[model samples]
Target: MTGSGIHLPMQSIEAQHLAELVEQFLELLRDTEIGEDAALNRLTPVVYPEDADASAEFADATSADLLDRRAADARVVQAGLVALGEGPDAPQQELSLAGSEVDPWLRTLASLRLVIASRLGIEADPSPDPDDPRLGVYEWLGYRLDLLVDAADELDGV
Candidate 1:
């Protein structure tokens, strides 16, 4: 399972959890109004932090296009997740995703992690207090994201 591809052996519960995560992410992508959601704001940050006018102008000009692209990508990832979740009867199964599938999967995972991190107020601190449950979830998402990224990079010969 250590190569340029993903070969994950997951239980039915794991697949269900992944599907739920992707569904939630897709809802956030499709339902949230731009500029109103804190998580979306974090996902799509201002281009020019020092200049309010410039940042606003940039956002106004590009937000629609950017959101459109994200929503489209989310749809693709949703379909993939749904397909992965089909075989619930199997107690144990190995799900394999090729390099072609990895790109969008990586993006979706990263976006989900970003939303979770934003909600959890995760920052540069590597050692967040374990007392907060959200922090633990955020850290786990980061770890998963990193694994996907590494696999994608290996596939791309990076």
Candidate 2:
């Protein structure tokens, strides 16, 4: 029996529970205050620049910025999840403000979403996947990064 008290093969893990888990993970990351060096090391290259040196710098910068941004975004997503689970006024849930994966399941989802979005030039759908933490993080990160990237693109255009 799972924490939710309902079990049906693989269907036991409900979306609400998964969302709660994600919230918890985000909260931990926000609170722990992991160093920037560790955060940068964990992230692999996504879109590399033409210049090898420049690409490395880009990756480093992106990772650092993302580490902080993701933590904030995760808090928002977690709040949404909590509201969905226990109603809007359940409690004032807080996050670490640092950033960390709520579950191992979300890592691949984040990578895949970024790849697909970059390739297709499309924003990801906001659907939440409870079974995979990676997908949840990806969904949250997608919207957040989209805004930042769009803003930068606009500034560059100007």
lDDT of 1 by residue, 1-158 (tens): 23446766666666677678777877887888887788888777889999999999999988878767766666766676566677556877766676566767777777777787777666566555678787766776677668767766666674
Per-residue CA lDDT of candidate 2, range 1-158, in tens?
Answer: 01211111111134354465556555544565433323223434446546878767776667556656655655555554444445333233322111222222234225335433433334345444456555554565565345434433443455
Error of 2 at 60 (Å): 2.6
lDDT of 1: 0.72
Tell me the deviation in Å of residue 85 in model 2. 2.2
| Number of the predicted model whose lDDT against the real structure is largest | 1
TM per prediction? 0.80, 0.36
Find the candidate with the highest TM-score and give its number: 1
Question: What's model 2's lDDT at 93?
Answer: 32
